[model samples]
Target: MITPRFSCSQNEESVVVKIYCPSVRASDIEINVDDTLFTVHINPYYLRLNFSQSLLEDDESSAQYDPSSGYLTVTLTKAEKGQVFKDLDLLSKLLAPRLTEPPPGNPIIEVLDSDDAADIQTDEDALVQATESLTLEQNEILEAAESDWQLKQEVPEPLSSLRTSPTDRYGFLDSYSGYFTHVEHTENEVNELGSEAETLPKSDRRKHRIEHEEKKWDEEYYLADYADGEHIQELLCWRHPHLQLPDVSYTPEEELAMLNLPRKEYLASPLQTRQLYLTLLTLLFAYAYESRTTQHDPTPESGWTLGILIPAFSALDPPPYTDKSTNDPSTFSIEEVISTFVASYRRSLAFPLYRSFALAESCRSDVASFLSKGRRMVLRCLLEMKYILDHHDVYYVYSKIWIDDFCVWIQANASDETLHQLGSLICSLKIPKADIGWDLEELEALVSNSEVGREADSDDESEDEVERMLPTPL
Candidate 1:
């Protein structure tokens, strides 16, 4: 049977298998389930998976096909809950190659040209002698042998997998982990084997060799925390292209570009207020993109977080509360703003706390202490999610509760300048009136009790000082 292009993921109780077979149909599909065994057949291709030793419960399996997506999902109930499967796509294991041993013999070897044959006179004499005596078949064989050696050389076979031990099986994670490890290495290559390694014991040297080889294999791969902007464009912004900010592909640049204001030419014909909100959307996701556990570190490729790049709070404040001045909604609500934050937070975090921590710790040598630390920070970020849903409430939370604690919390992990930018960014976001409306009077009242309101109205000389004191992540 032909191989199937498929992927598998799991929840607490079931394994979901998604097979990509765009040309297949429900009429051609077949599934057989037994208590520990599962089988899926689509015409000429079929998969038989025995999960007796796995977490699978082996009963009440189910399948569904989405014709539009051309994918079939099969759900297999799990015997055990909360047990993580290191792998679920066992097709590769079942399909381990059955290699036939080569016949025992010393294979014939090709010889280099004899010194006498290299000479024109000797070669001409030999050719003439062969033409005079040998049959056409014999001459053809000789001529073919002579010509084969002179043709373009064949490429040598690639080296085998870099896996050094049985436990070090190869997979996508292995490749990506190796890349992150390579990027972290900053020592002089010469020095690694020079005076420093010379002093180490034999065991240390062997370990070093293993690490070097692993890095060699993974140096070509890079894993990202989120899918591209194109992934969700249809879901969120089919018509609103400006709202669909593209996820960053690999590059020499940091995430600051995503958060920064769009250039003048990039903003099409839109009201000033709309431009302000759209630019705010860019900053929100940009902040989310950079929130990865490793992004705070200063690397050669992407240096320190460029917090000081954002305009100061005073500069971002909308012109003195006016409905006539700007076509921005008269009433602003915070529901959409909070929803956006929640969505972005989830996108940035990518996985549940437990799952994320597990992935981080696993990817760490294969990402290690650095990645582990990053996940811990992510845990803290999860706590910040609760207070970020509504504007009026966010302003109050920031002014009263969060400013006092969350500001310091972020400062511990990021630069002081970054903390200020985050504060400004949250304050800068204003959800335009969609359905329900609140006027400037209500907007002022929503923030009136908070320090953000005070700082927004402060004199330029005192603005800087007051802005520093306005810590309301509460």
Candidate 2:
């Protein structure tokens, strides 16, 4: 009989096992606990033995045992904890059956053991053989490779020789040399052409000299004789006979014409001619006065009368009055006649009319002097005229000359009484009606308010009163 008991415990590090077997002593029984069999520390072999013992003790269990071989087998109709024991039992039965059974046939195991040992020995020998063969093959390959490398090295030259030649290489180099030679030849040609071109200017100079000489010969041959000496005389004769003729004296008519005198027929009646000449003289005098007085320079001498002195003398001598009239003109005063003639002269000589006269020879000296003075008077008159024309609306042409001249004359020549009388005369003279074209009342108001006039009037009145108060001068 066999009895078995089992227990198990666990800690942090491993499992602890306790087993009790009554059939076997602990010392004789082996506790082969394959550490690999369970992750826990339970001994599997011991476990199996214990399981088998337990299964055998169980009620209704059918098991077979071989005590001689120390083997047992169990069969399970249902699985239980004791089934683990049956599984071990089956392994042991299969591996270690009764020794009484005939030895089982396992020729494959026998052959595999023998063959494996033989194969190992053969593989060792084959390895050595293969190493030796590889060494020999490598040596052969190295030799063949070296031979091939040398053959490759010698192959290129023959191929290159077959394709081209040294002469062909030289020909390529010579092509560039030929091009440079052509360039050099062209440079030589250009230098030769330049040398040829340098001579052209000298040739042109020679041709120009020839042409100039030919032109000089042609001019001398064709034109010089006709233009000089006798040809010029012939041209002159053709153009004008007088150009070559000698100088000649003037005839009377030509002389008279040159002098621009009246014709003989007109001069035959001395009186009428003299009157005409006087008229001419008067025109000339007016012209001279007008030209001399103006700011512009006079016109040319030809524009004036020719032979003026004799013509004017003949005209003005034996004055146009009879002896009675010369002694005294009854109809008009000499002053009136002189004034009329002067007025006529002034009219004729006004702008846009030009005449010439011989006043220097014709007029009496005193009259000439008076005429000369009258020129300045006429300039003053013209100034007054311009003022009148511009200021036609002004009431008066105030005579500053009268006041200015009277002031100076009184200072030089008058007594106080005479000065007073002169001042009174100046004050009493009525403003001219012709001059008072505009604003007379305004002018009168201005004069009435004049301080200077008032002062003078006061002084005059005081003097007059003083004189009246004294004894009469009788």
Candidate 3:
């Protein structure tokens, strides 16, 4: 079955989907609308979409086909009139299904009642009670300390609240709770650590380290290391030549056509999923690097680059992993996940940091090299994936299948030697002078002069001190 090309537009009361199916019979077209889902079937051409808001097949809803134009126009009424609909133009999101479960380890709140008497209590009442109780407690503490003008000391608890035993053995909930106990750290660093990190698996610790390192590089670092060079030639050689070539920018009509292209999800194995994510990281980094080097600026949105990377509309081509027995009509594919990684990164809070020099440097060689090395090297790419995954998006399924499994497998099977080799390899990687974009000789001379000046000042201070000590007799 062929999934037809389509486009969506919405007003306050209705959404219009225009599907392109050439030489189709109008009477043969069958349509189904169930709450948020909409499906269309006409012999060989099929299209399925899941909308954010529910749709109603009321009098306002209608379907029409223009045989000459090869367009099937289906109008869907909004469940609530005047309610605004969003993402009508984001066709990939519309094609993907909504998440069925909360992410692992999150609390699931069950709303048992909407209008019960217990639900009527306001926040102001709770705040007033809390304030009164705090005041009484403070009064008592002041009275006790009044005699000596100092509070009495008490014995420390045997264990910290943070160090209390975890409720689960998987350690996803409290993986890092015991980190400080076994390892020494400054009080402030320990205090700065947030509770949320402990809820994630231990494999994410490397991601946190990568984030921390990137934070240390500011505008000065970017200017010093990446912005000052003649980078276009290097970028062209480093990435694809096609990236440097100018192509006609997509018009609104063309963009809508690309957005609505028919696609399908692949039944990928765990190994294939891992390979897919690794490839995604490589592509995203290459895109970011190419943008920075050629454009001399970070790309705010990366979805447009997909056209240059892949042949136009080839993303919707039938994938190799299609299963005939369990095939579903939803238009999705591995390419869509790749596209989602780029789109999700744009939506992330850390999008601005997408082109950090540290990230590019890490991916410089390892992007392709890490693929053959299996889980250990793939973990490095996962650090990149961590930034792009954001909170929730299409890649969440891959996360559940591959990322979570890798985390568990690594926790059980990873040895100290593997970690040592990873660290050693990271340290061995050298940054070329051209890559740094800094004049090494000039920077070194400036540093040397500054140090010499500091030494002379120190000598003068010592001479003055000696003079002051001897001159008192005169």
Q: Could you say which candidate leads in lDDT?
A: 3
> How many residue pairs clash in model 3?
3
Global Cα lDDT for candidate 3 = 0.47
| TM-score-sorted candidate list, best first | 3, 1, 2
Q: What is the lDDT of candidate 2?
A: 0.29
**Using Cα atoms with residue i matched to residue i, what is each candidate's TM-score against the true structure?**
0.22, 0.16, 0.35
Cα RMSD for predicted model 1: 28.3
Which residue ranges in model 3 land beyond 4 Å of their true spot? 101-285, 295-474
Position 223, candidate 3: lDDT: 41
Residues 348-461, candidate 3: write the lDDT tens digits: 212233333344453444433433344334443333333332233332322332333333333233333433443344335454433232353455456567778999999999
Per-residue error for 397 in candidate 1, Å, reads 58
Model 1: lDDT equals: 0.36
Per-candidate Cα lDDT values, in order, are: 0.36, 0.29, 0.47
Model 3 worst lDDT run, 10 consecutive residues: 310-319
* Tens-digit per-residue lDDT, 336-365, candidate 1: 333333322322222211112122212211
Summing lDDT over every window of 10 consecutive residues in candidate 1, give the lowest-scoring window: 306-315
Query: Best TM-score goes to which candidate?
Result: 3
Off by over 4 Å in 2: 1-274, 299-340, 345-474
Question: Per-residue alpha-carbon lDDT of model 2 for 284-371, expressed as tens digits?
Answer: 3333343332312333331222111111111111122222222321122233233223422322212122221122212222123222
